[model samples]
Target: MKLKCLVIDDDPMICDLVKHFCSKLEEIEYCLSANTGNDGLQVLSQQKFDVLLLDYHLPDMTGQSILEIRSQNIPVIMITSEKDFAALAFDYDEIVDFLVKPLHFDRFKKAINRVHHGDSNSKSILQDDNDICYIKDGNKYVKVNYNDIHFLRSEENYVAFVLHDKTILSLIPLKNVEALLPSHFKRVHRSFIVNLNKVEKTTLEEITIGSRQIPISQKYKKEFFEILNNKLL
Candidate 1:
């Protein structure tokens, strides 16, 4: 399968070079390029990608910040000139490899190979089937089907995925999980992520999911209502 990839860098030349190199590889395909982290997030929000080539420094946000926000199974290769951040990058389980700037084509190819070969130490929580998510709870990874999920409630450090039968709490933040869920899941409030498929009804003030009623954020009310209306239509 051709790996769909995104290259995010402030340097135009580096982006072009990476794009060119990826074009030569039969197994890799360049999906898009972004000059800033914010723009990169916009692309990620709209499309699914297999790999990401991220620069450490960007005008709006650092690559690390973006990774923190959206932690999916997709491998993220850090492309930067800075050598000091290698250790820090390794700390992030999502970062597959670190590639220093003025990158050698051989090394770049090898990094892609690592992702293609599934050599990353961190096992992705995302599975091939869209209907289920495997979340780490204590010493075990619990599989929760998407249909079972009613809504996700975020605590300070952790989020609670409230299912129809029970709730599964994980150490990972809610925003990261939110990015991986399909469009059916919506952020009704800053603290709540609701499954549109499981939604029973919605009033002007609250959304009913199964037996639970979750409030909608005032700031997101208009957009939230629009999505709900569109879904029903």
Candidate 2:
């Protein structure tokens, strides 16, 4: 399948060069460019793209900051002049490859190949080939092990990932977050998704995880109980 792409870079020339490189390949359907992070995000929110070519430093924010709020589904190839940012960039799960500045068509082709093949040059520190995630906590991304997550709660437009010590709130719909989660996480109610491994007590009405009592709605009660019954000793 031909991939649609977006190049988000501060340098206009870099963007043009990438667009040119993309035109040379039949694998790339079309490539669009945005000069800053905000413009890129605005475009992303309006349209769906198969891959993102993100620059490390934009005038509005660092590329890492953008990764915090963006959709998890898009594969990203990080572009930067700084080799030092590679380690930091690879910490995000979306990143497929790290490209140094002054791009070459051959190197760019390799990055595109990785995206097509569903491969990354490095494993994400956030996921680390396991059930781990980095949740946005203020200005930083805090590492949270999946087992530590008692449950996820929906609050308005945000979803709160509740761990034992604290809760991290992200500006994403609960359903969108739900798709990225592992199978053990069950949607018990419209507002809640509880980790079965962390569940301490379960009743026909609610599930207890630590001090939190999550309601079980009629729509989900049967399947939730069925899973619990299968595990009962």
Candidate 3:
């Protein structure tokens, strides 16, 4: 399958160079470019990419800074002139490889091949290799880990990812997001889907995870209890 890639660099010439290098490999069918971190985030929110070719610095934000706030499951190849950040960049599991600027085709090709083969060290086995989904947050996509999601609550046209610290709002409906989740998530209420693994305490009416309690609707309570009971030790 052809991989969709994005190149985010402040230099327009570097963007073109990445596109040119991608063309040498038939595996890349689509490539997009952005000149700044904010613009890159916007582009990523709009499309799904398999590989990201990113520079270390930009006018709006540094590449490492962006990765620190939002985690993208897409394999990232850091191409920068600086060698100082290699140790720090490797801390992010999504980072596939770090290459010094003035990129060589052989090194670039290796990064693309790793993405094509789904060889990122951060690959998640519970869901897709990229076990994270980008939630549309205003003009940008906030990457939230699937495992970090304790539960989902429906709010009319929006859905909220209830995590340990904050609740992230997304435009997607509960059912739509529910469809994307794996078997570990179950709809115990029309407005709530709880990650069964995150559930710490349970009762007939509510499920407690961490410090929060999520309600279970009477409509689905019977079936929900049946499933939860089956897994009881």
Candidate 4:
């Protein structure tokens, strides 16, 4: 099926350029175009899209704000001239890719291809019963099983997935890892991701996983309770 896409940019020329580039790809169908973030939100409410080409700066709202309000399943590629904002974009795991201003057609195509391939692999992994996810570590991809994981601690740029008997540090950012993990895993704290299947119990402020007791941040209290309630029910 052709991947439906939405281009949300205030500039008419940039919008046209993106549309023209996407037209060459046989698998991409430019489904909608909006000149403002509000317009984009309206379009999102009315239709379903597989990918979103979003402008970072919008008259009404930032692309990041729009993304937070939109569905998580729709992959977003930020279109911005500010290269320094790339790190900020990574914080939002739903952003699959970033495109700098005056984007090269080849580079744009490659970015879209990566998002497409990632989505395909994620779908396949979801169908499998095995509780292992393969992530890129430096130059190689390593498979880490759920049973092997004891807990996850987030560092500045990476997450340390401490295993039962070993530890594997992944170069991929923590937010990205959190987004990819199954629902069984819970983010109890800002810097910690815990697999609920591995959790032993929970107190008012902390959760026990084996011998370690991880703190549950107030920001995630609602989600933590939801998980606990679901498990109990």
lDDT of 1 by residue, 165-202 (tens): 78877776677667667778889898999888887888
Error of 2 at 20 (Å): 25
| Top lDDT prediction, candidate number | 2
lDDT: which is higher, 2 or 3? Answer: 2
Instruction: Score every model by TM-score.
Output: 0.51, 0.54, 0.50, 0.52
Q: CA lDDT of 67 in candidate 1?
A: 85
Best by TM-score: 2
RMSD of each: 15.1, 11.1, 12.0, 15.1
lDDT of 3 by residue, 1-233 (tens): 99999999999999998899999999999789999999998888888888888898899999987777644677788878865455456656787666677777765775677678765321211121235544555444455677888888889977888888888876666766665576788999888999888989888778889888889888989888888889984
lDDT (Cα) of model 3: 0.76
On TM-score, the stronger of 1 and 3 is 1
Clashing pairs in 4: none
Q: How would the candidate models be sorted by TM-score, starting from the highest?
A: 2, 4, 1, 3
Task: Please give the clash total of every predicted structure, in order.
Answer: 0, 0, 0, 0
Model 1 gets an lDDT of: 0.77
lDDT of 4 at 191: 92
Model 2 misses residue 52 by how many Å?
6.3
TM-score of 3: 0.50
State in Å the error of residue 2, model 1: 1.2
lDDT of 4 at 30: 65
Residue 152 error, candidate 4, Å = 25
Q: Taking the tens digit of each residue's C-alpha lDDT, what string does model 4 give over 109-143? A: 75677566764322111111236454445444455
